[model samples]
Target: MQSCSPFDQAQRGDVEAKFQIFLTLLAVLAGTALLARRVNIAPAILLLIAGITLAFIPGMPAIELPPDLILLLVLPPLIYSASVAMSWREFCANLRPIGLLAIGCVIFTACAVAVATHYLIGLSWPVGFLLGAIVAPPDVVAPLAIARRLGLPRRIVVVLEGEGLANDATALILYRFAVAAIMTGAFSLTKASGTFVAILAGEIAFGIAVGWLSLRARHWVRDPQIEITLSLLTPYIAYWIPEHHGGSGVIATVACGLYISWNGPLLISAATRLQGIFFWDLVIYLIEGMLFLLIGFELRAILERSQGIAFEDIAVATLLVAAIVVVARFAWVYPATYLPRLLSRRIRTRETAPSWQAVFVVGFTGVRGAVSLATALALPFALPDGSPFPDRDLILFVAFGVILITLVGLGLTLPALVTTLGVARDGRSELVFEHENEIAARREALAAALTSLDALTDHRELSNQVVALLRARHDIRSQQLPASLDDDAYAATANARALVRELIAAERKFIHAQLRAGKINDEARRRIERDLDLEEASLTNRESGTAPL
Candidate 1:
């Protein structure tokens, strides 16, 4: 082989550099998480601050963020993770408010922000609208994590989650229209409206098709490794198919995630289900860490790149736009939260009115994040005729400013706000409710299993030993729970199961010792071990009052 060329060597160096940067970022994240725990602060907020600090250090590597990376690499899995894990029941029950906020409130906020930008910031209508689109939707990632940690009311969290999932598509559609109008200097309201409808219908249909096909494919392929790999690909396929055909990838991804999430219990094996949850959780953690860190990196880069705009000027614009975003949310949320109940008797009767305090928390937690920065950066540097994009630098700075203010300012303050408003839900009550439901489900399942066993043991060909063993297992399961379990009864049931699990563990250790001593052959040992493995697994599920695989 010929000696490697200079270009090849350079390429190798570049790759090495990138790998080093990735490793360093991971190290930083690990350190930040530990430090955050020590300080009793949210890791996300601290990680963002750490990233900004890293940016300012001397001789630090400059990480160039590609615009498409956020949409393509970062968005799909995050959206899918949130969607699949969301409560479809709660989502549907709160559909009215979610729709009003995701659609109507998005439009309202965008319009209000646009008018503010035009009049106060002196930007043109199109550019102002573009800015509005950039900041319209609160990012799902940060707020959801915070809400869950703070233990806010479940319904309020659901509403926030629902709005985060749905609003991105709406804002993106508006962004596209505004960009088209700016570049071509032409737009049609009627045509845009029709296109919006077509896009929505097409994306939803596409998502359903992807979800259905993927689930069927998963069922046909039984291997856990293969199934888990397919799961990793599901969100991307959901996004890619729609986006390739002129539809919203965000809508497609969310739909597919929701579909899979709802049906996951039926389709997935227990092993795959557990492994997949762990894998996705890890993936989400890494993605979010990098995404927020990159936000800080981008902030410094954009500010440095901005020309002729004073720091004070950018600061003022940021403050004004930030104030607009917050006020606009309050203005829209109060009406959107309560107006439907006032107008429609059906809504009033079907749903309980949310407390005013909860509504305030929702309004205050509207923190703009990575998506906004990505949208701002994604704007074209030049129009078709080679003219520079109007106010691109200003828009970028403004967008970064809003993200910083919202993410750091509002994000850091959210816990205190919730505390002040007395809106956090009672953790014990929620746990008790879940325990009650689980107990009821277990009781029904055990009764059915026993009934089926009683009917099956009547077979003349069935062995008495096999039937007896099956009966013993079912009886043990039923005994692990009580006829009526209150908190104390549940604890007692847990203690009994713990004793059973310890006995199984002792049996497992004895079997392993026998295998090592060569008193048991490998084949005999494996047979016994498999039985022990399954028994232990069953015991674990039972202890938690979960159904057996």
Candidate 2:
């Protein structure tokens, strides 16, 4: 074979270097996540620190985060996963508050940043607004992770999750408007407002259509692997179609995920769901870990490029912007929480007014994340006439700084803050109630299933032995469920589960021995092992108190 050219050799070398960097990042991501779990800190925070550390290490390559990688590759799945997990009923029930935060608060924060930066920092209004739009939305991944773990009230969790899912669309739409205004040197409120409405309606409709089609196709195909593949593709199809046509694909993805969430149970198979959940969980975890690490790495690259700018000036601007972001949230949230109840007696009758502590927790949890950084990085280098984009570097630095402050600073403090304010006191009680409800529901369902079985036995010529076996299986399962997860009951369940796991281990050991002894073929051994594995997994779930009703 002929020797490769110098250009080809260089290209190959670059590819190899990038591949090595990717492998190294993966190692760092995994380690950081494990460390976070051990220390009980949010993984995102540690991952960010790890990235920053790695970035400064001698011989480490400069890692550039392309906006497309985040917006296109990373975002759709993150949004889709979150939306699917959200309860549509809860989302709709709390529509007013979610909208207040997702729509009103985003706009409020954006405007606040815009006005502050313009007056204090001397940036032009359009550019300032662009910066505002970049950092407006609270990140879904980091804050929600912390909130769920903290055991806040379910409604608070729902509101936060719902807000995170939808706010990006609002911020992004505003971002586009700001960019257009900057580029054209003119802006129209009326025109932009109407366009925004149209885009929202259109994207929602399209997203629903995508969800409908995805479910139907998956149902038709009826293969676990194929169905999972289709599910993976669903978000992208929902996202890219409207996005290419000038819509904020965020809403479309959210709508699609919600539609599927409500409808998927009946259509999707158990095998697909069971396997897909694990697959998606792993995918999201890796993506999230790597994203945070990359975000940290971005700091080094940004600092290198900002050699001319004074560190003090950047620090002051970052501090000012971060302060404004935090304060604006508090200012808007209190009024938004109480003002509606004051104005509308209907609201007061329908819902209890939340405690100020809960409201404070919500306001404090406004941690900016990767989306802000991505938006900042995505800003064009030049305007329409080839003029340099004003304060682009400053925006990037501030956006990253704000993310650091909010995500790390606020995230680390939120747990203690929730405890100090007693927001989770009711949450603990609610969880107990939920566990009891779950047990009740399971009993009711099994009773219904047994009633159906009795009916089937009477109608069909079923053998007594078959009927007895079926009834006994259900009885055993029902009996295994504890009446309550009290300390005594939990201890008994744990001991029982441990014994059962030991039994499963013994069975697995025997099966492997048989295979080794040639008493069973490899296929037969695998089949038996799978059954044993599932039984053990069920026990594990119950032991962890995570088994579904």
Best candidate per lDDT, number? Answer: 2
Tens-digit lDDT string for candidate 2 (419-441): 89999998887877888888898
Pick by TM-score: which candidate is best? 2
lDDT of each: 0.83, 0.91
Off by over 4 Å in 1: 1-7, 38-40, 426-428, 482-549
Estimated TM-score for each candidate: 0.89, 0.97
What is candidate 1's CA lDDT for residue 147?
82
